[model samples]
Target: MGKEFSSVPMYTESAEVTKSFDDDGRIKRTGTLLTASSHIITAVIGSGVLSLAWAIAQLGWVVGPAVLMAFSFITYYTSTLLADSYRCPGPVQGTRNYTYMDVVRSHLGGVKVQLCRLAQYGNLVGVTIGYTITASISMEAIKKSNCYHKHGHDAHCSEPAYPFMIIFAAIQIVLCQIPNFHELSWLSIVAAIMSFAYSSIGFGLSVAKVAGGGNNVRTTLTGTTVGVDLSGSDKVWRTFQAIGNIAFAYAYSTVLIEIQDTLKSKPSENKVMKKASFIGVTTTTIFYMLCGCVGYAAFGNDAPGNFLTGFGFYEPFWLIDFANIGIAVHLIGAYQVFAQPIFAFVEKSCQKRWPESKFINAEYMPFMGSHGFNMFRLVWRTIYVVVTAVLAMIFPFFNDILGLIGAASFYPLTVYFPIEMHIAQQKIPKYSFNWMWLKILSWSCLVVSLVAAAGSIQGLAVDVKTYKPFK
Candidate 1:
C-alpha cells in the first residue's frame, strides 16, 4: 500500500475563520437581489399615482413624461441615498432603528430635535389627513356613482355622499384602532394585488383604445375651465407642484431602518434591503409612466379627479365600479399603514395618564372595573376621524389638500432627516461637507415642497368657492 501520511492540522492562533454554507454547501445568507423592476412598481403605486394622469395631462404629452421622469429620478436617487445612509431596517417596524427626533438631536443638537419633532408631528398629521381625505373621496365617488345610477341624475345624491363619508371614516378608524399593526400586512398585500390588476388592465385598455384609432376630442381650452390650459403660470406652478408630489412619494425613509433591523441576517441585510428598494422604486416608476401616458391619452381635457377622469367615458359601468372598489381598498390599506404609528403613539400617551383604565386591552372595553370604553382611545380615534372627515367634506377635490400636506412634510422627513441621522452616526464627517450634490438636492426639495404647499393651499381655497349645499 502507498504510504499514507496523516494530514497535519494547520493551526494559527491569530487567524480566524468563519464558515457559512447553504444546503448545498454554497455561501449561506448571500444577499438576495431584488429586481429593479419590482421596486419601481411598489414605490410609484401609492395614492399619488392615481392622480398623476390628470397632472400630466395638464402639462400636455410633450412636457408630461419629461417632468415626471425628472421627478422620478429625484425621488429614486434621494430614496437610495437616504436608505444607504441610515441603513434603516424597513417599514415593518414602528420606529426606524433611529427616530427622526433622535437623529436631529444627535446631528444638530437638542434645539433641532425639537424642530424635527414639530416637523415630524406635522408630517404624520398631514399624512393622516391626506389618507383620510383620499379615502373619503373614494367613498364619495362610490356613493355619488351609485346614487346617480339609481336616480338618473346628480340631484338627490349629495346627502348620501356625506353620510357615506362618515361611515367610511368610522370603518377606517375602527380598523386602525386595532393594536397589532402587523396584521394589516394582509391588507397591504391585497391592495398591492388590486393595484397591479387595475393598473395593468387600465394600461392594456388604454393602449388598445389608442390603437383602435379612437376619436380623441381635445376639450375647449379656456382659463375658465379648471386645469385645461397647460401654458402660462399654470405650467410653472405644475412644475413646482410636481416636487411636492415627488417628495411625498419618497417621504417614508424613516420606515426603512425598521425594515433593515427586522432582517434575519444582519451582515447581509443592507444588501437585501437595498435590493428591495431598487425593486420597489423601479417598478413604481414604470407603472406611473404607463398611468400618466395612458390616462392623458384617454382623457385629454375632462380628466376626472386624476386618472379616473380618463376612464369616466369608458362604458361597462361595472368595470368602473370595480376600479373604484380597488381604489377604496387601496386607500384603506394606505391609511392603516400610516395610521398605526399615530395610534400607538396616542395609546402610549393615554396609558401613561390613566394607568387604571382597562380599555388598554383588546376586549374593546375598559379594564374589569372600568365603567366605559377606554375614553382616551375612543376620544382620540373619534377626533381623528371627525377632523379628517370634516376636512375631506370641506375640500372634496382629490389632489388639492393631499398635495399640500405631502409637500409640506416631504422635505423634512425624507431628505433632512436622513442627512441629519447619517451625520449624527458619524457615517459622514460633520465638518468635511463634501457631498455638494446631496446638499443641493436637499435644498431643492425644500424649496419645491414649500412652493407646492402654498399652491395646494391656494388651490384648496379656490375649490372651496365651488362648494354647494347638499341637494
Candidate 2:
C-alpha cells in the first residue's frame, strides 16, 4: 500500500548507495519490509483469488472460511521456514541462496534439488498459464459487461475467449522485456494496488447484492445440496477442487527466498521476510474473507467462479468494467513476477551451454543503458508467452486450471520442501516433537494435494466432454 507516492525513495537510484554490491557482488540489497510485503501480496493474491467464492460455495459457510484460515497459517509458517533457508549456516550470517532451488541444494542436496526445480519452475509456468486464462476471462467479461450495459443481463452476450488471450499475450510480450526479477518492485507495487482495487470492488458489489435484497440466494452450513445441486460424486470432487482453490489463493512461498534476497543485509533477511510474509498473508486473508464470504452470500450455491467477471452484478456495469480492467492490468505484471525466475534459469542455462555462441551470450540494443538486449532471451521469452497463451486458449476452464495449479504447487513448494529443509538445516533430533509434528504436517498436506489434484483432473475430464479446444 505504501507505494512511495510523489517522493521516490532516495536509495532507489544507485548513485546514492555507499556500496554497489552485497556479499554476493550483485546489486546492493535495497528492498525494505514494505517492498518485500508488496511483492508478497502481488504474488499471493493473484488470479486465483477470483475463484474463492466458487471455492467457498463448494465448502459451504462453515468450512470455507475455516479452510482459508488454515491455509493462511500454513502458508505463513512455511514461508518463515523458507525465509530462514535463504542463508545457509544460520539465518543472519550464512552465504546467501539466490533461488529456491539453491536453498534446496544448500540444505538438502542431491535429488531434492531436482525436485525443487520441478516444483518451483513448474508452478511458476503453471501460474503464467493461469494468469493468461484469468486475464482473458476478465477481458471477455469487460466486453460482456459493455454488452449487458447496452442490452440487458439476459441478452445473448457470449464472447470467445481466444482473442482476449491473444491480446493479453501481446502485452506480456512487451513487458517481458524488463529482463529479470530485480527491477520488479515497482511493478509489484502497481500490481498490488490493482489487486486491492478489484478485490474491494468485488466485495462492495457483493455486499450491495446481499443488502439490496430479495431471497435470491441459497446457502447451507456444509455446501451445495448433493441431490439437488449435484450428484454425490460431484459433491466430493467439487469440495476437493474447492480446497485446491483455497490452496492456490495462499500460494507465494515458492518465491519467498527470491523476494528475501532483495532485502538489505543489516537487518537479517529472514527476520524482515517473516514480517513481510505475515503482513502480506494477513492482508490478503482479510480481503479473501470479505470477498469470498460476501460473494458466496450474494449468489449462494450459484456463485460464479469469478466474482467480478461472472456477470453476478450487471447493473453496476461501469464498475464491473473497471474491476475487470484492473484484473487484466494486474495479471500483466504478475505474469512476469512468476515468469522471471523461469526466464533467468533458462537464459543462464542456455548461456552456459553455448558460451561461444553469440546469439546466446552477446548483448544488443544498448539504448536501455547498462542492460542491453540479448537475442536468445528475447526469442525464448516471447515463445514462452506465446505457448502459455496458446495453452490458455486450448483449455479455458478457469476453476479446473486454478485447482490443478494449486494442488500441484501448494504441497511441494509451500509445505514439503520448506519443512524438509528446515529439519535438515536445524538438524532437529530425529523424533523430537517439532520434527514429528512437521513430518505430520507435510504428510497431511501431501494427501490434501493428491485429492485436490484428483478433483481437478475429474473436473477437467468432465469439462472436456462438452468443451471443444480452440473453438
- State which candidate has the highest lDDT: 2
C-alpha TM-score for every candidate? 0.75, 0.95
lDDT of 1 by residue, 1-471 (tens): 222232121233433434543222223333233322222233236667777666665556665677567666665555555554443323222123333444345346757767776777676666666666655555566656666666675456653356767776888777755543434545656767767866765666567656667556463322113444454566566555544554465555534443333333443445566676766666677887897667656665555545642235344445656766776677666666566556765676666676656555323333443222344566677788778777666656667755776787777766776655544444555446555556777787777778878767767776778777343
Could you say which candidate leads in TM-score?
2
Model 2 misplaced stretches (Cα beyond 4 Å): 1-18, 368-370
lDDT scores in order: 0.57, 0.88
TM-score of 2: 0.95
**Which residue runs does candidate 1 get wrong by more than 4 Å?**
1-44, 84-99, 102-109, 143-160, 217-231, 249-251, 254-269, 309-311, 352-379, 426-433, 468-471
For residue 418, what is the lDDT in candidate 1?
A: 66
Cα lDDT of model 2 by residue, 353-444, tens digit: 88778777766655545556667777998999999998888888899999999999999999999999899989999999999999999999
RMSD of each: 11.5, 5.3
TM-score of 1: 0.75
